[model samples]
Target: MKSPTQIINRELKAKKKCQGNPTKKYFKELIDYYINIKTLNEFCFAFLKIKITAKIAIFYFF
Candidate 1:
């Protein structure tokens, strides 16, 4: 198995390579790697609910 040090070194090398602006493809790849369809949908729904609730609260107070 790879040692912890080896894994860290590999990640550090990748970090250095990412110092420049990332391309659109790389950005999308990173997003896809980190988030799945379900999670993205949950985030969007939660955001919309918050905005709608805030608008209602403002309307009631005004």
Candidate 2:
């Protein structure tokens, strides 16, 4: 979790650079950051596949 002060400072910088409220832009950047982190995406995808596989197995067995 980001510290409040750190989050505030980043929002201030982003807002100044964008010359408006930064929430939307910040989220875009956040998504881009996550995409760039392939390991995290891979972990999430693997977990999701596991969950779906488990559900399918249960559906067929019961």
Candidate 3:
């Protein structure tokens, strides 16, 4: 079975490959969004916190 670290590494690599922007631009934009954010309400609404939590739970189980 793949380790948790292996799964996380795979996910990161996939994200890096699929993400459209250059790495530098992506990080800059992410940093700006985090620094300027007042609340995670919008973020949570977009992502749906419960769904992500369930995903994490499933990952742990696997």
Candidate 4:
């Protein structure tokens, strides 16, 4: 088993190694991806609603 100090030092080193622009760019990309997915979902939902409404209209009319 590792000592507590060894674990702490390792964690600190990892934090220092990762601190900078890479993290920011990753988050920005993540947010952009989320936004794109949300837009696509909304578009699909709208399309489905229109399609269902059309089907209902045709059923009643025919």
What digit string (tens of lDDT, one per residue) describes model 3 on residues 17-62? 5478534443454344434545566445324533564466468656
Per-residue CA lDDT of model 4 for 3-38, tens digit only, reads: 446534743554465557434443344334334443
Instruction: Look at candidate 1 and tell me the lDDT of residue 21.
Output: 37
Candidate 1 vs candidate 3: the TM-score winner is: 1
Listed per candidate, the RMSD to the true structure in angstroms reads: 13.3, 12.9, 13.1, 20.8
- Per-residue lDDT tens digits for candidate 1, residues 1-62, read 33446534743554466656334333343344334434665556545644564576468656
Candidate 2: clashing pairs of residues: none
Q: In each prediction, how many residue pairs overlap at the backbone (N, C-alpha, C within less than 3 A)?
A: 0, 0, 0, 0
Better of 1 and 2 by lDDT: 2
Query: What residue pairs clash in candidate 4, if any at all?
Result: none
Off by over 4 Å in 2: 1-38
Worst 10 residues of 1 by lDDT: 25-34
CA lDDT of every candidate: 0.48, 0.51, 0.48, 0.48
Q: How do all models score by TM-score?
A: 0.37, 0.37, 0.35, 0.36
lDDT of 3 at 58: 65
Q: Write the per-residue lDDT of candidate 2 for residues 1-62, one digit (tens) a residue.
A: 43446544754565476556344564454344334434665547545644564576468656
